[model samples]
Target: MNTNTTIKDIQIISLPRIEDRRGNLSVIEKEVLPYEMKRVYYLYDVPGGAERGGHSHIDQQEFLIALSGSFEVVLNDGEQETTVSLNIPNKGLLIPKGIWRELKNFSSGAVCLVIASDVYLEEDYIRDFDHFIKSKNS
Candidate 1:
């Protein structure tokens, strides 16, 4: 796995939205994303001021979107950190492997949609901050 990644590597993608008189529609194709999506999941009904996602992946990548409402994503690359806000349905954040992420500051009734590059695996996750730093140094 490549450990020489930084928070700058993260990408914000703007999806195409088709507006009409009835309703608006947004489309996401496989080619538009940075990786081929293998898993799809969503986070909803989070209590106010709650947080989620506090780990880094070894071989998985993810794309996160705010389906409704808004929230913040805090990203850390063992050295530097930054926060990104997701409020628009047509905008998505692409998070590559080796970066630790934390989701926080969710508004009421917010829905977070996530698309992953790989299936879930326990061994691929770095749950400890010390371990993540060590991995990046090594």
Candidate 2:
């Protein structure tokens, strides 16, 4: 494995909150966070006891937020790992590059929002766990 450390800001993101009598809204924009606009994705209706995102990106930084419900994200920076649980909509986890991450232990009916620092490049993503390890080492 690479054994290289991924940049992690210990500070949680504080999103802009707008409230009204009917409902409230929180916005996540590229300027709001530290990264520039690249790509955005979301995962929803994740089955119980199921998992997703068992992979890593070589040069991608992302922010993960739970829009609804909750889930656990296991991030391994080639050595020690950190477990980040997502339940709040206004806060997000800054996921640095060159780290292996797996989104597992998903609660029912969860929505995950990811704002990335790069465009959707399949070649940039290490989709397989074994390949990710090998590429990290190389």
Candidate 3:
């Protein structure tokens, strides 16, 4: 793992692999999926320079992977900041709750897979940077 490009101090956990000639299978089910996966979504066909997340979740946890092409996920944990560039299908960055995250610098044809711990809810999101900073400490 690259320290400078780390999203968090928690070493990014790589998903387990199950190889096969027919079709390699990997599961992201429940608590067995490295970190418990509660929700899943994928971002695709993104235009150049378009950003995805510009907010932070109050309690939801997430793990993001580049299923195809490449992109960067910038993370801020109140004080320090880090940027992670993911370009591998099998590799993922686990983002814990309370961290402000923004997804950007997406390469054309990039496909991002996100596994989250909670369903989509507008109320669960902290879209304001000021609120995120305040909530990080609270």
Count of backbone clashes, every candidate in sequence = 0, 0, 0
Indicate whether candidate 1 or candidate 3 has the larger TM-score. 1
The TM-score leader among the candidates is 1
User: Candidate 3 has which clashing residue pairs, if any?
Assistant: none
C-alpha lDDT score of every prediction, in listed order:
0.94, 0.80, 0.77
Prediction 3 TM-score vs. true: 0.82
Name the 10 consecutive residues with the lowest summed lDDT in model 1. 1-10
Give me the runs in candidate 3 sitting further than 4 Å from their true place. 1-10, 19-25, 34-36
The 10-residue segment with the lowest total lDDT in model 3 = 1-10
Taking all chains together, the TM-score of candidate 1 against the true structure is 0.97
lDDT of 1 by residue, 57-137 (tens): 998999999999999999999999999999999999999999999999999999999999999999999999889988998
What pairs collide in candidate 1?
none
Off by over 4 Å in 1: none
lDDT of 2 by residue, 41-122 (tens): 9999887888898888877778889999899988876546788888989888887778888898778888999989999888
